[model samples]
Target: MDRLIDAIERTQNPSVVGLDPTEALVPAQVVASFADEVRDSVDTPEEAPAAQLAVAFYEFNRTIIDAVAGIVPAVKPQIAMYEALGPAGIDVYTMTCEYAAEQGLYVLADVKRGDIGSTAAAYAHMLTGVNAGASAEAGSAGAGAHDPWHVDAVTVNPYLGTDGITPFVDAAKTADKDLFVLVRTSNPSSSELQMLDLADGSKVYEHVADLVERWGADTIGEHGYSRVGAVVGATHPQEGRALRERMPRTFFLVPGYGAQGGTAADVRGMFDANGSGAIVNSSRGIIGAWRTSGRYRKDMSADDALALVFDTAREAATAMRDDLRAVL
Candidate 1:
């Protein structure tokens, strides 16, 4: 938590770029460019397409990471974007996290994993890196205990209650990593559960917010924030503001800013008086900037397309920084 706070202060930017790449977001030419490279690398023709896209996803993530390395303090890479392609994509997701960390940026993995006691402990290994050779994607047989995920934090689901979340909290404390529990999400369907009224006179999200704060109580860092963070969507401004007051020690991983129609003003209340408690995120709005930049050409070569990706992504990231800075 202190590490992330230091980064935020150093970069003076509390906005994190979401490195979520999709087939529609990545340039076709770039995907095609890797056809020859992965054609023979795959086990069969059925595996070649996914393998090529996985490689392209890495290239896209690498380019975006290089572009925004110094401007932004962190990046949130949603695992589902890569997991959709199967095993090859999962490798790329880890590769993206490793690269972002290598470039001195915080990586927040949006995995949202939750389950009962033992199962939750197994998932906590992501932060603890305690499982040796857990996944072959992990560097080597003995490298699993050495921060194989390369992420500073991860998003978790709290539906299973304390028994489910305690492992992640303990793992975070042991590994000096952090975790954000989903509270008030930005998606349209999140309200189906998060906004439900509990018999205790509080909403579902409010109850979860209290649990999240309690879970991180013992691990508050020098920055006045705990190792456990709350994922509060930018779209729910009034509620987000109240949550900010409700959980002073809990940091925020705010999502749904740009593409989801959340403006800087909408999230201003999520921060504390010092403007240091929350970090906002923008996914397609940044990584997919090239598509909407009007500077892209279908006929452009792979190198040229990637160059555009870098330029546009950087521009968008800078703009987002300024936008958030203006309000803070």
Candidate 2:
């Protein structure tokens, strides 16, 4: 949490760009260009489309990473996008995280997995890497040196309660990483469950907020936030502000900004008074800016298309930074 705060201070930006490249989001030319390169890499012809798209997604992600290296403190690569393509896509997700870290951007993996017992323990292993022929102790001991995920933090689900989350909290402390438990999400339907009334007459998310605050109570860092953070969607301005006070030691990873219709004003209260407790994320708004830029031509080469992606992403990122700064 302190490290992430330091990064925010260094960049003077609390925004994290989401590297969620989809088939429609990526330039068609770039995906087509990888046909020859990915065909031989796949086991069968049926897998070529996924393999080629995976390669294209990596390239597309790299361009965005390069574009916003200094402008933003972090990049949240949604794993679901990569997981869609199976193993090949997963490789790109890992590679994308590695590349983002190489460029000095904190990587927050969006893997909202939550389970109990051993299953929970195994999922928590994501905080630390597991190397071949190595014991679990030895694996986490390798830390970033042998870690394949290359992420500084990850997003987890809290649907299963304490047992499911405790393992991740312990692992984050041991690995010096962080985790954001889903509290109030930005999705439209999230309200159905998250906003339900508990037996105590409190909202479901409110109770979860209490748990999230409790989870990080002991690990308060120099920045005054704990390694255990909460994911409060930017769309819920009033709720986000209340959570800020309720979870004093808990940092926030806010999503649903930009393309999701979350404005700077909408998320302003999510941050602390001094603007230090939260990092807002924008996905399609940043990475897919090129699509709506109206400057693309189907005849452009792959490199040229990526160059457009870089320029547009950088411009969009700068605008987002300035937008958030204006409010902060």
Candidate with maximal lDDT: 1
* CA lDDT of each prediction against the hidden true structure: 0.92, 0.90
Candidate 1 per-residue C-alpha lDDT over 48-85 given as tens digits, one digit per residue, 9 for 90 to 100: 99999999999999999999999999999999999999
Q: Score every model by TM-score.
A: 0.96, 0.96
Clash total of candidate 2: 0
Candidate 2 lowest-lDDT run of ten: 136-145
Provide the lDDT at 151 for model 1: 84
Residue pairs in collision within model 2: none
lDDT of 1 at 218: 95
lDDT of 1 at 88: 95
